[model samples]
Target chain A: MRFLLLVIGILYITPVLALSPPTGRVLLTLTGSITETNAGHTAKLDRKMLNALPRYSITTKNPWVHQAHKYSGFSAVDLLKLTGGKGDLLRITALNKYVIEIPITDFTKRGAIFAMRKDSHPMSVRELGPILVMYPFDDDPKLKNETYYWRSIWQISTIEVLTSPSKE
Target chain B: MVKWFRKWLPTSKLQHWYVYGLLSLIVTITLLASSILLYSYNGNQATKQRIYEDSLWNALQFQLQSYRFLNYLVQIDKKDLPLNGAAYTQYDLLMSRVDLLRSGEVGYLIRGLTGGRTVRLLNIITGELELISLNLSKIEEGDLSYLQDMTTRLKQLDNQVNEFTILVSKGTNLYIARQRRALGENLENVRILMMCFLASLFVLCCCIAKGFSVFKINQRNNKQLLIDIQNIHEEKAKILTLVAQEARPQIQALLGVPCDNTESSNSIKESANELLHTINMFTDLALIDIKKLSLDITTESLQKNLDDYVQIFSSKLQRKGVTLVSYIDPALPDVIGLDFKRLKEIILELLLNAIKHTPEGSISINVRPSSLTPTQQPLNLENRRIGILQIAIKDTGFGLEHAIQDTLRASPTTQDNQPLILQNNIGLGLSLCYRLVHLMRGEIHFSSEATSGTEFWVDIPYEVSQSSPENISLYSCPDPKRALIFTTDNHLANALRLQLSSFNIEANRYLEGPYYDDEDLDLVIIMDSNLISPEIESNIKQWQKNGTFVLYDHQLTKDVQNKAYAAKAQSLSFPLTQSRLNGLIMDAFKTD
Candidate 1:
């Protein structure tokens, strides 16, 4: 009876220790202060894994388009939850090596999202896709300001959660 | 070809008005054409400017829409709304805006302004929107991390697009400025063209005014010329009438007497005839010179006329003791185109010159077909086959003096320089002859030596006529009869005796007394019937009853005329011609 209980405990803890690796080509990677990861010290995700997060749809205008467009993707809060990341700031990188930093509250309080599909279609790299950051500028008029507009990143390849300098 | 061209050209009389009207029409047409061209050019430029401005405005609208849509998308992302059909619709609308900005005329304008960078910006924006659209599923699942990054890139794109819009506005404004400058230049050109047209019009008006003045002057001159010509014609006609009517009759009277029996009488008669012929020739020449008369050309016997002329002057030659010789070619045509009156004057002039100059020598006149040297022939008569009758009159006398020859060689305009004696003699005669010959299309040449002789030759063209001509000569008295003349004038009695002797008639003259006692007389001629008394008249009647015919002169009293008529006598007028005297004598003898 003792052996069976130990076996059940090990089985329950093994999943927490070893996360399932990405089944397809990795589309995004999260590092630094991330608790849940499929690779060591980092969380690697494919298109399928990214789709498994809590979904959101944003209908808003951006500097790149003339009208409001519907963007379907996971909220940054849910993506953070999936990676088990805790940070005061988040640094994002694009495929072109372009980088930008944003406050963690922009994702948690503002409900910003990483869009993977536009108009119900998956975006290609040529479309600045696989990932794009979109603020809910239509819902919160404050997000339509320049500060929030600059925070919205496109063609995202990686994210790094970092603690505040004071906390370090 | 010249005549055809002249037919289309305006005559001198109408040229002024025609040229003025043509110049005015040309100026007006040029003005109209220039105005039309200016208007069309301005209209085309305006159209082109409008097109450029329209394209600029379109580009501006597209850029504005792009910014607005971008703002909307930011709001939607911030709200974290569900991916819905409305959002996709907005996205599509934004994409279409970018597409419009990248192509067509708007694209070209933007590209020109941005150095081709505007297209790249547009492409970037489109790519970003498409990427966002492709990642819609991930974005809808609460993955909002990429929003900040996309917003920053889009902000940069928006800045670039805004710059493109500014460039477009500036380019359109610059185009408008350039077009305005071009328009001003066009207006200036129109002003200059208008000024040129006005100046041309002014010049044309001046020309027309000058032309009118010239035309008026010409008309005045023409009127004056016509009046002058009319005066000349009247004067020529008057002179011609005087010679024909008065002088000719008087000269005929002088030539009526038979003066061959005495040298002095013969010389006096020849001098009177020569003077009369010279006067007639001078008057005719004056008429011809003024173009008031034409030579009356006719087919006549030149030889016959020449013979008559020589015969009339034969006694003058005899008195001068000069032998006269003449020749006529048999090969010459029977009749030729000759102005008989003019030819007579020319021949007589030559003969008189010959007789006057040849004091103690001979004169020879010859007529024949001329083999003229090329230099002697008139150019116009070169190809003609008609007979060239050359008449040459040569005289053995004092040849022309050097001074006289020089005077003759001088032009008629310089005739005043000639000595008065020469001008009154040979100068006047030769000039007259020259003019007359030229009028007949003939040429005359002369050669002379001092104290030797002078020879004159004339070559005249003549047309042959088909008809034969009759010969002209003096009439001869048939028979001679005895007559007694009673005249108070001694000179008249002597002239009558001399005239009667030439006809083979015997005449007894009594100037101061009259006797009708001659029984052998066939006729008695009384010079004046008034001189006869009743006793004499009775005696004449007794004589007439004894078969003697009586003749009375003119200027008789009516009673005397009746007495003479009753006595069966005839009356003769004074100053009788030779033919008239011969006719009277023949009539009287026939009656006897």
Candidate 2:
């Protein structure tokens, strides 16, 4: 039993992940320059699959929201880890076809998150959900700017990591 | 402005307004620095907002979402496919775009871009989009017609959104252009302000640097000037020494070996002697002024020196057709320790000064005690006498100008290089005399009565003298007798009485207020005839009857003299000498 507990502890401390294939409807796709694959060099994530990972909440205000709301989501850094994504730049696409390219540092350095729920309730498609790329604006004054605002694309459908044109 | 300020400011302003200028410069620099900081702060805030560009992007995204949704609806109708999750996603994405444009900061930007028309247009579009969204599930199974109608409506909505986006793009472009122009103007202002501030700072620094150099140069020049002045002073001393050491002795030796014994030869000798003396005095003056003159104080005959000066001046007076008379106090010491050369110079110069201006009238030099009468002075009849010896040179010349008189009357303030110029002819002589007298801690006083005469009396302290005339005359009189002086209490009478007392003729004095009425008075001398009242005249006549011989001053009138003869009183000259007074007394008591 002690040996089993130590193994679990080692698994928790290390960034070793064995993400299983999704059984629910896929809500997000990760392709290009990813190590882990559920469907041939791609990661198709379902809501339950993302939910199985650790959850996070960011209480922050934005232009789209009237007041600060506790947005429950998966951390962008943890999600990238689950997909085993690698690249300097992240190319994101929203359901509305509004696209933005951001540096990976926004996830690793600025603590960006993909919100699926607001105030403990799952958001509908019309409510800018499934995934909303958000920054904890109240945490860092630097992130509360137009550049970061434009980078926070909502209803995100896809994230493509571009290592290089030749690699793709 | 500077001229106006200068006109208003006091005359004694600093040579350069560096301090105030530096203060104003500091204030200006502070103001300019703060202005730049404030400008940068505002620019930072505008950069932070970046709201206009964000608003434009949001509007474009809203319009694009509308077209994309419309396109999807059209594709569904063309393909005759059942509307499913894909169809719902497109509708939801369009709804979210509309929501984003209709609410919050992006919504306000669209409203402003469309002149507030975005609100109504968005409301109608939102109603239509919501209607389609509500019936989207049903449309997925049965009717292509309803989907086609919704597609046309969404196309119309996309057109409206495109119009709003165009307006936003135009407004954002205009705002950005205006901001760029304003930024250019602000940058230009900052540039000009920076240039002005730097130029002023440069000028102030240059002025300070130049001021420092000028101050250093002036300091060097002043030091050089001091050295030059010292050189000039040394040169003057060398020249003075050359004249004193070489020229004066040559003149003296040339005089000693006479050429002819003629009047011209004698005159030349006299002139040579005068030149030697004048040169010596100037050398002495320099020494005395610098407080370097040392006296050869010695015990010498003060009376003999005085008599010698009197005799020499008397002969000079005779030749010049002027009289010189001297009256030495009979009670002064015969020997005293004093600087004889300086004393001789003082007397000779004073006499010469008087003779030069006198023209005709006599010059009288009187020597006496500066303080109490000879009898009242502290005398043990054996030891040395200590007193202030007053030597008064009274000339009957046309008196001095009141200005010169007042100056001489005031005691010497200091024994300095520049002696008091008592008069033009008096010149260095009397001035030198003033210095000499002060060197011995002496005082000089004078009085002038316009055309009457002037008297300069020098009173020197520390007179160390051996025998007084009063002591000498005590033996000169041979007998000590009693005499009554019926005289006014005047200085002249007091002096004469004191003289008589020195002659051992116990003299009693009387003024007009009271009479020394002694019935057995052998002899009576009346100094002032005006004091001879009727009762005094009767007593005088009685004294005559009792064989009491009497005398009166020669200055009395004929009427008083006749009365004096009736009262057996004789008339005699005033200022009687010691020998003359003794002779008169012996004659008066010959029968005894």
- Which lDDT values do the candidates have, in the order given? 0.68, 0.70
Lowest summed lDDT window (length 10), candidate 1 chain B: B413-422
Candidate 2 deviant stretches above 4 angstroms? A1-19, A86-88, A162-168, B1-17, B41-45, B77-82, B221-592
Write candidate 2's Cα lDDT for B1-592 as tens digits.
9999988564422335455457557866885886679698767747634777777777777777777777777677545564457778877877777777777776666676656766767777778778877668766765666876787777666666776777778888888888888778877777777777777787677657766776677789889987885576566555666788989668978788747767677677767877887887777765664456776666677756776666554435645655454556766666666778878888888888778767765566678878732343222223555576788887777777665555665644565433445333446777788778767666677776657667778777544554433222323345556666765444344455555665556666665544455646666777666777887887778777877668765556465756745445666653234445556766776554
Q: Between which residue pairs do clashes occur in model 2? A: B331-B470
| Model 2 residue B351 lDDT score | 80
Can you give the lDDT of residue A36 in candidate 1? Answer: 88
What tens digits encode model 1's per-residue C-alpha lDDT throughout A104-159?
77777897888999988998654557788898887887775557755777668899
* Structural similarity to truth (TM-score) of each candidate: 0.32, 0.47
DockQ in order: 0.01, 0.46
Report fnat, model 1: 0.00
Model 1: how far is B183 from its true place, Å? 2.7
